[model samples]
Target: MKTLKSRPSAILFSCRARRGVLARGLNTTREIAMPEYLSPGVYVEEVDAGTQRIPGISTSIDRARWQSLVAEFKKTVVPQAPAWTDSNDTDPGVTLLELFAWLTENLLYRAHDIPERGRNAALRAATALSVLGHRCTTECATLTRAHFFAGQLLDAATLQAEQDYHREKLRRHNRMLHGFGIVSGLGVHVEATSDPGGGRVIVDPGYAIDRCGEEIAVCTGATLAFPSVGNEAFVSLRFWEHPCPPDSPSASGEPDVTRVEEACVIGFAQAVSPPALALARLIRADGGWRVDPAFVPPRAGAVMA
Candidate 1:
């Protein structure tokens, strides 16, 4: 079974990347327990393409600026020491710490030519602002829209809907956008099997409803993983994507997947951070704020590469 800390489509990126890993000493881990502490709420898995057990994969994504933003935001917003004694330590979401962390990350200053990762981070952070019920201003919306592919994809009706949703987020989102100069009103939809009996229910990405009616993207995490015959597993993970269902609202009370419905909300919360910071940092204006020291990674669960 191949081991990868990356999401399903993760690690499995490139065969050549794996060809060199065997020489990188990871080849031996295949014989033992899995690797540890890569990202919070995230974990690497060992996969096999039949004869080959423990095969690792590496792949290329849209190369959005969000990647850089996450790296930078992680380096800055997250903490070295636990925010509070007895913090979950594993998931790290005690208090509004994540919220403050979000604010702190948005305060970071970058260069004029934002990297793709940075662009993604900026967009994600803006999205978070909205989730926190922060509104988006014209400037903030424009700044965020500059790099947000989803926003650009909107038609006049959709655009108007988005703007209306922004206003609905407590106050007008434009205020948060302009006042804080950051992205706001980010929302995520988690869709469990509308019908769980379909064998392995496919919680298709961005397939759920966003009741907020905002232009929130969907970022998924491992709800349930299926073990393979070769002792390997196929875990599902979702990346940030366009909001097609603007008027859709997530089902209330419980997610269709009983186990998933019972799963902690932290799991879903953890999925947003990386994608959020990535989008925020992507198109954030340069030389705007003071740069803080890098934040240490979270202790467990959500693992990064």
Candidate 2:
């Protein structure tokens, strides 16, 4: 009998000689069942290796997965196609990948909420997706409109008005329910002089919550003229939100004026005692500028909410 040894990594098999012929014969099989032997002396054998275990490919979809796929494409395909070097989100390939990711996420959400139904389900899904940083598509927008307004068709102006109304409502709720006052550092100090006209009251830099629940940041100290004698005046911090011209131009000489959201002013209400919203009160008698006995300067770093 001639003995043959297969490669070390392959399964070992032996064939014995009987009546001048090999007792066991080699048979052809599927490619995966056994590796083919092409060498002249190589022999094939059928071995029942049981069930083959094939590893599963990942089908998980997520933002990270999409990002990794983009990275892999950039690594493998960019070299072959030099013209497609741009890997930014603006790139068509990257944008398509993002859209795919969004669709996958949306489908996964629907699958997770398979039992959900009706317009409320659509609205909830749209709101949840929006919270997840997905922009509302036309269908989502329609669903949201139907849910909120009983399917009323809103024009641009009407939509803006509705938005403004809700915003003001929220603001009022915060201002009234939460209570507002000088949160810190709006101390009133009178620079007294023999002539009331020459005197001034300085308001230190401070932060406050106005009646509108809007935060007032006094970046720098402010000064207001002293009230005339025999008159009472109260200092109020007012907040206004409007667009103002930019203070300077950009280095590129382009116009950089943007609308400012918050504009605050230190104002005075004369002949009126300090109201609940007043930061300080000025009582001017025959004496130059008298601090009202009832007036207490807001303590530094004290919250008056």
Candidate 3:
């Protein structure tokens, strides 16, 4: 006696009298598995060609292109091919094509997302990133203005002692910088030493150095106000120096300018020597100087010391 064989899997979705009859259409949401028939003896349901076609610019065109290529090649180039059975995970060629398609799809996605504005926002951002120089100010008028907190009273002797301590700190900081091969007092930028009287210590570093020119402006802008009639005043400034003005035509041509926040006194009277601080012209390094309070001189310096 002969027995009946099970129908092909594709017939389940295509035929209405198989699983469709069993579920009675109540669970119509259930997914129907479809199989691809390869040989003449195999039977499979016909698939809608339109279902495989991707829509819109956001869709994966590269994958569609690869599939079309494979289908056309199978039909026209190798009509009788038997080794090419299925496009599955086991096929190395299919995997490679899929990888290539994914990368191409990503490129196409980014291209599609580019903004349609008149001015290129991306180009502007890239240009801003290439700037080499920057300027800033702390709005300090005089050294005394930065010190001496209101309501925090100190005797004249005590105030004098505090001032002396700050000056000494500046001297030591400068000396450390000198030992590091930054000879000129001008090369060192110092911050305002903290005062014990609870006044906010303000260190104002002001300097404008241009890469194209060797000129360095210590303190720019006119004086806001002078110290009280008879008393003397101090002005502190700090800044970082670059090797030279950038003059290249490449993307990295921007000079790396550094600014420091330190204090010093520039006395109006020729009578007193400028506060015991020294400054020298910014020397050129191969790359540039690094901003470090405890910077030690090395055997050789590159873009940074």
Model number with the top TM-score: 2
State each model's C-alpha RMSD to the native.
Answer: 22.5, 36.1, 36.8
- The C-alpha lDDT values of all candidates are 0.26, 0.43, 0.27
**lDDT, candidate 1, 62-90, per-residue tens:** 22223333443453434543343344745
What TM-score, to 2 decimals, does candidate 3 have? Answer: 0.15
Q: Which sections of candidate 2 miss by over 4 Å?
A: 1-173, 193-196, 228-230, 246-258, 271-276, 296-305
In terms of lDDT, the best-performing candidate is: 2
For residue 38, what is the lDDT in candidate 1? 35
Model 1: per-residue Cα lDDT at residue 162: 64
Write the number of the candidate with greater lDDT, choosing between 1 and 3: 3
- Taking the tens digit of each residue's C-alpha lDDT, what string does model 3 give over 1-305? 01101111111111211111100011011111122332332222222212222121121122222333334345443435656755579788989988998986697578874333311332232212212122222232234312566797777667667765565444344333332221222333222223221111122223321211112233321111121123222222212221111234336643332221121122122132211222221211232221233433221112132
Better of 1 and 2 by TM-score: 2
Looking at model 1, how many pairs of residues clash? 74
In model 2, which residue pairs have backbone atoms overlapping below 3 Å?
Answer: none
Model 1 global lDDT (CA atoms, 0 to 1):
0.26
